[model samples]
Target chain A: MTKMTMVEALNLAMRQEMEKDDRVIILGEDVGVDGGVFRVTDSLISTFGEQRVVDTPLAESGIIGTSIGMAVYGLRPVCEIQFSGFSYYIFHQLEAHAARLRHRSQGRFHVPLVVRTPCGGGVRALEHHSESREAYYAHTPGVKMVIPSGPRNARALLVSAIRDPDPVVFFEPKALYRAFREEVPEEEESMPLGQPQLVREGDDVTIISYGAMMVPVLEAADSLKEKDGIVAEIIDLLTISPLDDTLIASSVQKTGRAVVVHEAPRSFGPGAELVARLVEKSFYYLEAPVKRVTGYDIVYPLFAREKAYMPDTGKIVQAVKETLEV
Target chain B: MPRSEIELPYRIEYLSILDENGNLDKELEPDIPDDILVKLHREMLSGRRFDERMLNLQRQGRIGTFPPIKGQEASQLGAVATLKNSDWMVPAFREALAEFWRGKPRENFILFYGGYDEGGAVEEGRNDLPVAIPVGSQMLHAVGIGMGIQYRRKDDVVMTFFGDGATSEGDFHEALNFAGVFQAPVIFICQNNQWAISVPRSRQTHAKTLAQKALAHGLPGIQVDGNDVLAVYAAAREAVERARTGKGPTLIECFTYRMSLHTTADDPKKYRSEDEVKEWEKRDPIPRFQAYLTQKGLLTDEVVEQLEADIAQEIQGAIDRAEKLMAREVDPLDMFNHTFAELPPSLILQRQEAELDLSLRKEEDRHD
Candidate 1:
C-alpha cells in the first residue's frame, strides 16, 4: 500500500493501465510536458513518451471528436477536458456521436473512451472552473458517469472507467486532489463502478452524497454521532449515472429518514434523483420528507464566498438532525 | 523549410485536366490504364443511375427523403479512389458515391436512407464511419482517426468529405486547427457544390474561394475541377500521398455544382433560376468523362451498351433483394441492447417494459 493523494493515486492508476494495455492512450491539452493544469498527469509524459501521452491543441470539441474516432477505431483513449466547466464545448460530440455510435451502428461500433475533467469548487477558483455539471452528462443516455470522493476510490474508479466498454465521463473532484492522503493499493485494488460504498453505517438517518460533498457529509456524520448522539449512515455514490438506486432505497427504507448532500445546485442535482428513487421505491418506509444539503442555485462564487455557497458540515449536520427528528 | 517569407504574391490555382468536350490537357493527364478508365466510367454511370433510381423511388413513396447526387459523381469517385481498404473514411450524408466507390455496398447505402440501423452496420474489418447526419462533425472524427494512425505508427490516412456550408460550423475550424497543429494524417475534401440548400456560396463566405480558407489554418489547400475526374484524381492522389508519407494534412476543394434538389424535400426551382441549372447540366461529370474515354478509343457504343445493361441488372437485383428483406428491419428493442456494453438493471427493466408493451399490444390486436 502506498500513501498518496488523489492526484498521485489517479496518475498511478493511468500509468498502470497504460503499462498493462498498449492500446490505452492519453490525449488532452498540456497533458504532456505541462502535466495538466493541476499536475494530475505530471511525470506521465516521460514515463509513457510522446506517442502514448499526447498534448493536443486547445480545442475541446476536437479533442472529444478525435477521441471518439480513436475509440471507434479500436484504441482506448482517455480524453481530458481540462475542467468540467469547459466540457460544454464537447457536449455535442459526447451527446450526439460518442453516446449514440453503438446504438446507431447496431453494435457494429463501440467507443471505449474515458473523458476526465476536474470538477467542483473548494480551492477558490475563478469562473467556469468550479462548476458541477455531472447532471448534464449523466442525463444523457448511452454514456456512464463516474465520480470519486477520495484517493482510493479515484484510483479504482478511473481504472474501471478505462476498462468499461461504453464511454465514461470520469469527474475528478479538484477540491480533494490533495486534501488528504490515504493508503491506496497502487496496483492491487480495483473497484467496480455503478455501486455505492457504505462509508459509515448507522440507523437513524442515511446520508447519500458524492464528489466533493462527501468530505463535508462524513464530517457531519461524525459530528452528529459525537455531539447529538444521533447515528447517521453515510453512503458515498461512486457512480452517478447507473446509480446504486437499490442501496439508497434500502438504506432509506431501513433508516426511515434521509438527507442527500451535493455541491451541485439543489434544483435538478443527483440529490433530486436519489430522493425520487427513495420515494418511488420505499415511499411508505420514509418517516419524514427527504432533506437536501446542497449548493445554492446561483453561480458558484469566488474564494471569498466559496464555503458559504457549498454545503458544509454545519449545514449537513443540521439537515441530518432535522431528518432524524422526523 | 517550415519558415518562409510572405513577400511573394500567392494565388490559388484551379486544375482542369479534361475540358467540357472531353479534350484532355496532354501534359496534365494521369497515365491511367484503359481497364481502370473503363472501370471509372462504369462506376460513374452506375452512380448516375443509382441517383436516378433513388429519385424515382422517393416519388413512388418507397424510400425516405433522399439527397440527389446527379452531378457530383466524379468529384466523389476521384478523391476516394486513392484510399486503400485499410484506411478510414468519415463521410457525410451526400457521400454515397464516394462510399460506393470505396467498396461499401450499395445495399448498405440503400438501407441507410431507407431508414434502418443496419444501414450503418459496417461489418467487421471495415473502418468506414457511418454517414453522419449532422453537418461538419465527422471532420473532427477524421482528425481523431488520424491521431490513432499516428499512435500505431501506421502509414494510413483518414479522409472526411463535407459540403461548403459545413465549413461555416465551429467543428470545421476546430478540426482544421487540430489537424494542422498535430500534423495529423487527414485529408479534408470539401465538395463545393455551389449551393448549401437555399443559401448561395457567395452569401456563405466573403473569401474569393473556399480553398484559400485552409491557408489560414496552415494547411496546403488545392482547388480541382470537380467536373473533371482526371483533375480531381490527380489532386486527390497528391494530397493522399502527402498525408501517407507523413507530410501532414491537406485540404482539397473539389469545385462542382448540384444539379438536383438538395433532397427529395427540396425544390431547387423555387430558389434558383432555370438558367443556372441549364448551365450546370452542360458541365455534367458523366458525359465529360465519357467524351474523354471515347476520344482515347477506350469506350465504344458496344461497351457502353453492355455496361449500362449490367449496371441496370445489378441495381434491379439489389433492389429486389432489399425490398424482399423488408420484414427483417431492425427491431426497436435494439435501442436498449447497444446503448451500453452491459445493460444495467434499470435498462434491463426498461427493456422488459418495452417488451411488455409490445406483448400487450399484440394481445389487444388478437381480440380485434
Candidate 2:
C-alpha cells in the first residue's frame, strides 16, 4: 500500500496497466512531453515510449474518433480529453459510434476504451475547464460513467475502466486530484463500475455526492456534528449513470433525510435524478422533501465568481438544518 | 532535414461504359469467362426484383420504411462482386443490393423494415455491418476494422459503402485521413446516387466530381459509370487488389442515380421533375446488361424466364417465412439491455418499475 493523491494514483494505474499490457496506448493533447497539463500522464511517455504514449495534435474529435478506430483494431486506447467541456465536440462519435458498435455488431466487437477528463468546478480554473457536465454522458446509453471521489477509488476504478469490455467515461474531479492522500493497494484491486461507496456513517441525515462535492459534503458533515449535534451520513455516488441507487436508497432509509450535491447546474443535474429516485423509493421514510445543493443553471462564470457558483459547506449545512427542522 | 512545405491537389475519376441506349460500348468490354458475366447479370436482376418487391410492401403498409435502390443495382452488385466472403462490408442505407449479395436473408430485411431490431439483418463475423443510418458513421468503423485486420496481419480487406451526401460529414474526412496515415487495408466505395433526400448532387458538392476528394487524403480515387456493371466491377477489383497486396487504401466513387424516391415515405415528385427521371430511365442498367448478354450470345429467352421464376419463388418464400414467425412481445427493458454487459442499478430499478406496470395491466385485464 502507498499513500497518494488522486492524480498520482491515476498515473500509477496507467503505469501499472501499461506494464501489464502492451496493447494499451494513451493519446491526448499535452499528454506526452508536457506530462499532461494536470500531470496525470506524467512520466508515462518516457517509460512507455512515444508510440504507446502519444501526444496527438489538438483535435478532440480526432483523438476520440481515432481512438475508437484503434480500439476496434485491438488496441486498448485510453484517451484524455483535456477537460470535460472540450468533450462536447466528440459526443457525436461517442453517442453514434463508440456506444453502439458492440450491440450494433451483436457482440462481435468490443471497444475496451477509457476516456478520462478532469471535471467539476473548484480551484478557480479558466472558463470551460471547471464545468461538471458528466450528467450528459450518464444519460447516454452504452457507455459506463465513473467518478472517483478520492485517490484509492481513482486508482481502482481507472484500472477497471481500462479492462472492462465496454467504453467508459472516467471523470476525475480536478479539485480532488491533490486534495488528500490514502493507502492505495500495490496489487491490482478494482472497484466495480456501478457501486456507490458509503464514505461516512451517520443516523440523522444522508448526504449523497461525488467527485469535487465530496469535499464540501464531508466538511459540512463535520461542521454539523461539531455545532448542531447532527450526525450526517455521506454516500459517494461512484458511478452516475449506472447509479448505485441500491446503496443510495439504503442510506436514505437509514438517515430519513437526503440532500444530493454536485458541481453541475441545478436543473436536470445528476442530483435531480438522485432526488427523484430517493423520492420514488424512500418517500415514506423521509422526514422532509429531498434537497439539492448544486451549481447555478448558467454558463460557468469566470474564476472570481466560481466560489459562488459551486456548492460549499455553508450551503450544505443550511440544507441539513432545513431538513432537521422539517 | 526539414520537411518542405508544398501544396498539392489530387484528381478523382468516374468511369462508365454503358451508353444511354443501354448498349455496351464495344471498347470497354472486360475479358472474363462467360459464366462469371452471366452470374453478374443474374445478381443485378435479383437485386432489381427484390427492390421492386420491398417498395410495394412499403406502399401496402406491410413494411415500416425502406430506402429503395432501383437504378443503382449495377453499381451495388458490381462492387460487391469484387469482394470475397471473408472481406468486410460497411454499407449506408441504400445498399440493399450489397446486402443481398452478402447473403442477408430477404426475410431479415423485411423484419427490419417491419420495425423490428435495427440490426435484423446483421450477422456478426459475416463480413458486413448493419445499415448505418447516421449518414457517414460506418466509414470510421470500416477504417478501424481494417486497421485491426492489418494489425493481426490478416489478408482480408474492408469495403465501406457511402453516398455523395456522406462526403460532407466530419467522420468521412476523419476516416479517410486516418486510413491514409495508417495505410490501412480499406476501400471506400462511394455510390454517388445524385440525391440525399431532396438535395441534388450539385447541392452536396462543388468540386466538379466526388472522386477528386480522395486526393486530399493521399489515396487514389476513381469514378466509375454506376450504370455500367463492368466498369464498377473492374474499378472495385483493382482497388481491392491494391489493398490486399499492402498497397494501402483506395476511394472509388460510383456515379449513379436513384431511380425511385429516397424511401417509401419520400415523394421525389415533390422536388424532382419527371424529365430527369426519364433521362435516367433511358440508361436503366438491367436492360443494358441484358442487351450485352444477348449480344455476347450468353443469355436466351428461356434462361431469362427460368431465372425470373426461380428468384420470384425465393423472394416469396422469404416473405412468407418472416410473416409466419411468431412476433415476440416487445420488452420495454430490452432498451436497457445490451447497453452494457451488466445493468446499472438505476436501469434495474427502471426495469422493475416497468415490470410493476405490466403486472398492474394484467390485473386490470383480469378484472375487465
Candidate 3:
C-alpha cells in the first residue's frame, strides 16, 4: 500500500490498466507531454508513448466521439475533458451517440468508453471550472455516471470504470485532487459501481454524499458526534446514476432520518431523485422529511460568494440537526 | 526587409467519367470486372425500387418518416463498392443503399421504418455501424475506427458518408484534422446531394467546393460527378487504395442531387424550383450506368426488364418478411433489456414494476 493523492491514485489506475491491457488508450488535451492540467496522468506518455497516451486536438466532442468509435472498434479509450464545464461541447455526442449507440444498435454495438472530467468548486477557480453538473450524465440512461470521493476509492472505481462494458462518465472532484492522501493498494483493487460505501456507521441520522461533498459530510459527522452527542451514518455514493437505493433505503429505514448532501444545485438535481426514492422505499420508517443540503438553485457564484454557495460542515450539521428535530 | 507573399501550392481536382447524356469518358472509365459491374447495376436498381416502395408505404401510413435516397444511388453504391467486407462503413442516416450493399438485411430497414428496435440489429461480423441520424456525427467514428486499425496494425480502412451540409459541422473538421494528424486510414465520402431539407448547398457554405474544405485539414480532396457511377467508384477506389497503403485519409466529394423530397414528410415545392429538378432528371444515375452496361453488352432490354421484375419480387418478399416479423407482439421487457449488459438492481426493480403493470392491464382487459 502507498499513501497517495487522488491525482496519483488515478494516474496509477490508468498506468496499471494500460500496462495490463494494450487495448487501453488515453487521449485528451495535454494528457500526453504535460501529463494533465492537474497532473493526474503525469509521466504517462514516457511510459506508454504517444500512441497509447495521445494528445488530442482541443475538441471535446471529437475526443469523446472518436473514443466512442474506438470503443466500438475494440480499443478501450479513456478520454479526458479539460474540465466538466468544457464537457457541454461533448454533451450532444454523449447524449445522441454514446448513450444511444448500444440501444440504437439493439445490442449489435456497445461503447465501452470512459470520459473523465474534473468537477466541483473549491480553490478559487475560473467560472466553468468549479460547478458539479453530474446530474446531466447521471440522467442519461445508457451511460454510467461515477464520482469518487478520495484517493483509495478513486483508484479502485477508475479501474472498474475502465473495465465496465458500457460508457462511463467518471467525474473526478478537482477539490479533492490534492486535498488529502489515502493508502491505495499496490495490487489491483476495484469497488463495484452501484454499491455505496458505508464510511461511518451510527444510529441517529444518515448523511448521504459523494465526491468533494464527502469532506463536509465527514466533518459534520465528527462534529455532530463530539458537540451534539448525535451519531451519524455516512454513505459515500461512488456511483451517482445507479443510486444504490438498497443501501440508501436500508440506512434511511434504520435511522428514520436522512440528509442528502451534494455540491450540485438544488432544483431538479440528484438530491430530488434521492429524496423521491427515500419517500418511495422507506416512507413508513421515516421520522422526518429528508432534507437536502445542496448548492442553491442560482448559478454557482464567483469566488467572492463561492464558499457561501457550497455546502459546508456547518450547514450539514445544521441539516442533520433539523432532520433529527423533525 | 520587404514582405514577400507565401503561396500554398494546392489545387482541388474534379472527376467526371459517365456524362449526363449516357456518355462515358472512355479514358477515365474504371477497370471493373464484368460480373461486379452487373452486380453494381442490380444493387443500384434495387435501391431505387426499394426507395419507391418505401415512399408508397409512407404515403399509405405504413412506415414512419425516413429520408429518400433518390437521385443519389451512384454516390451511395459506387463508393460502397470499393470497400472490402473487412473494412468498416460508418454511415450517416442517408446511406440505406450503401448499408444494403454492405450485407445489412433489407428487413432491418423496413423494420426500422416500421418502428422496431430490432431494426437496428446488424448481423454478427458485418463491419457497419448503425445509421447515425444526427448530421456529421459518423465521420468521427470512421476516424476512430481508422485509429483503432492503425493501433491494431490492421490493413482494414474505413469509409464514412455524410452530406455537403455536414462539412459546416465542427465534428467534420475535427474528424478530418484528427485523420490527418493520426494519418488514420479513413476515406471520407461526402455525398453533396445539393440540398439539406429546405436549404440549398449555396447557403450551407461559402466554399467554392465542399471538397476544398479538406485542404484546411491537410488531406487530399476531390470533386466527382456523383451521378456518374464510374466516377464515384474510381475516386473511392483511389481513396481506399491510398488509405490501405498507409498514406492516410482522403476526402472524396460526390456532387449529386437529392432528386426527391428531403424526406417523405418534406415538400420540395416550397423550397426548390421545378426547373432545377428537371435539369437533374436528365442526369439520373441509373440510366447512365445502364447505358454504360449496355455498351459493354452486359445489359439488354430483356435483361433490364427481367432485372426489374426480379428486384420488385425481392423487395416485396423483404417487405412481407418484415411485416410478418413485426406482426408478432413485441415484449415490453425488451425495452429495458439492451441498455446495459447486466440489468442493475434499480432497472431490475423497474422491470418488475413494468411486468406487474402489464399484468394488471391484461387483467383489466379481461374484466372489460
Candidate 4:
C-alpha cells in the first residue's frame, strides 16, 4: 500500500490494466514524452513502450474517432481527451458512434473504450480548460459516466471502466488530482460502476455529492457535527450515469431529509436528477423538502467570480440546516 | 503580409486508365482477368438496378428515405471489389453499392432503413463497418484500425470510403497525418462525386484538387477517373497493396459525379443546372463499362439480356427477403437491448418504467 494522488492512481490503474491486458493502449496529446498535461500518464510510454502508450496529434476529434475504431477492432484504447472542456469537438464521435455501437450492432460489437479527462473548475485554468460537463455525458444513455472524488475509488472505478464491455467517460476532478493522498493498494480493486458510495453514516439528513464537491460537503458535515450536533449522512454519488438510486433512496429514506450538492450548475445538473430520484422513491418518507447547493447556472467564469459561483461549506451547512429545521 | 515560405508541397499525379469514349489505354490498363471484368460489369449493372429499385421502394412507401448511389458505382464497387477477405471496409451513408459488392445482403439496407435493431450489424463474420451517417468520422476510425494492425504487425489493411465534402472536415487531415506518422496500414478512398448535396466541388475547398489535400499530411495522393471502373480498381488495388506492405496510407480521389438527388427527400434542381446533369450523364459508370465490354466482344446482346434477367431475379429474391420487416410492427422495447453487454441496474430500472408506460397506453387504447 502507498499514498497516491488521483493522478498517480489513474496512472496506476491504467498501468495495471495494460499490464494485464495486452490490448490496452493509451493515446493522447503529450501522453508519451510529457506524460500528459496533468502527468496522469507519467512514464507510461517508457514502461509499456511507444506501441502501447501513443502520443497523438492535438486533435480531439481524431483521438476520439480513432479510439472508437480501435475499440471496435478489439483494442481497449483508453483515450485521454486532456480536458473535458475540449471534449465538445468529439461529441459527434462519442454520441453518434461510440455510445451507439452496441445497440446499433445488436450485440455483435461493442466499443470497449475509456475516455479520461480532467473535469470541473477550482484550479482556475484558462478558457476551454475547466468545465463540469459530466451531465452532458451522463445524459448520453449509452456512455457510462464516472467521476472520482478521491484516489482509491478513482483507481478502482478506472479498473472497472477499462474492463467493462462498453464505452466509459471517466472524469478525474482536476481540483482533486493532487488535493490529498490516501493508501491505494497495489492489487487492482474493481468497483462496479453506477454505484454510489456512502462515505459517512448519519441519521439526521443525507448530503449527496460527488467529485470535488465532496470536499466541501464533508467539511460542512464536520462543522455541523461540532457546532450544531447535526450528524449529516454524506453519500458520494460516484457514478453520474446509471445513478445508484437504491443507495441514494435508502439513505434519504432513513434520514427523511436530503441535501444535494455539486459544483455544476443547479439547473438540470446531476443534483437535479438526484433530487428527482429522491422525490420519487423517498417522497413518502421525507420529512422536509430536498434542497440543492450548487454552482450558479453560468459559464464557469474567471478566478475572482469562480469561488463565488461554487457552493462552499457555509452554503451547504445552511441548506442542510434549513432542511433539518423543516 | 508575412514573407513567402518555402515550396508548399509536392503535387501527386492523376491517373486515367480509360478514355471518355470507353477506350482502354494499353500502357496504363491493369491486367485483371477477363472473368473478373465480366463479374465487375454484372455487379455494376446490378448495383444500378438496385439503386433504381431502392428509389421505387422509398416512393412506394415500402422503405424510408434513402441516399441513391447512382453515378458513383465505379468509385465504390471498383474499390470494394479489390478487397481481400481479411481487409476491413469502413463506409459512409452512400456506400450501399460498395456494401452490396462486399457481400452485404439487400435486406441489411432494407432493415436498416426500416428501423430494425439488427439491421446495423455488419453481415455475420464480415469486417465491414455499419453505415456511418456522421460525415468524415469514419476516416479517423480507419486510421485507428490500421494503427492496430501495424501494432500487431498484421498483413491485413484497412479501407475507408468518404466523399469530397469530408475533406474539409478536420478529422480528414488528422487521420491522414496520423496514418502517415504511424505508418499505419490503411487505404483512404474518397468518392469525389462533384456535388455534396448541391454544394459544388468548387465551393468545398480552394485547393486545386481534393487529392492534393493528402500531400500536406505527407501521404501519396492520386486522382483517378471515377467513372472508369478500370482506373478506379487499379488505383484502389495499388493503394491497398502499398498499405499491406507497411508503406503507410494512400489517398485516392475518384473523380466522379452524383447523378441523383442527395437523398430521396432532396431536389438537386434547387441548386444544380440541367446542363451540368446532362454533361455528367455521358460519364455514367454503368454505360462506360458496358461500352468497353461491348468493344471487347464480351458483351453481346444475348449476354446482356441474360445478365439483366439474372440480376432482376436476384433483386426480386432480395426484396422478398426484405418484405418481412415492417416499420409499425417493430417492438419499442427493442431500443434498450444491446445498449450494454449486460443491462446496468439504472437502465434495467428505466426499461421497466418504459414497459409500465407502454402497458398503461395499451390499457387506455383498450378503453378507447
lDDT of 4 by residue, B1-368 (tens): 88986775456788888867777799998988899899899888998898898899878877666789898888888888888878889997898888887788888777666534456677677888887665677889998988888788889998899998778668788899999899888889999988766456775677889898888888889999999999999989999888888788899999999988777766666557899999999878887788888888889889999989999999888887777654335565655666568877766665564455455556646976
DockQ of 2: 0.02
Cα lDDT tens digits for candidate 2, B1-368: 87987766445655777765766656876665788789888888888888888888877867655788899998888888888899999998888778878888778877666654433547765789888766677899999999999999999999999988778667788999999999999999988889766556775566888788788899889988888888988888889999999999999888889999876756676558999999888888888889878878999889999999998998899788776642545453343445467776765664564455445545646976
**How far in Å is the alpha carbon of A101 misplaced in model 1?**
34
- Candidate 3 global lDDT: 0.87
For model 4, state the Cα shift of residue A31 in Å: 40
Candidate 3 TM-score, C-alpha based? 0.58
For model 3, the stretches where C-alpha displacement exceeds 4 angstroms are: A1-326, B1-10
Docking class of 4: incorrect
TM-score of chain B of each: 0.95, 0.91, 0.97, 0.95
Between prediction 2 and prediction 3, the one with superior TM-score is 3
What's model 1's lDDT at A134? Answer: 93
Candidate topping lDDT: 3
Model 4: chain B TM-score relative to the native chain B: 0.95
Candidate 1 lDDT over A45-97, as tens digits, reads 89999899987654578789999999999999998877888788789999999
Two-chain DockQ for each candidate model: 0.02, 0.02, 0.02, 0.02
lDDT values, one for every candidate: 0.83, 0.82, 0.87, 0.83
Residue A209 lDDT in candidate 1: 93
What TM-score, to 2 decimals, does candidate 1 have?
A: 0.56
Give the distance in Å from residue A118's predicted Cα in candidate 4 to where it truly belongs. 30
True-contact fraction in model 4 equals 0.01
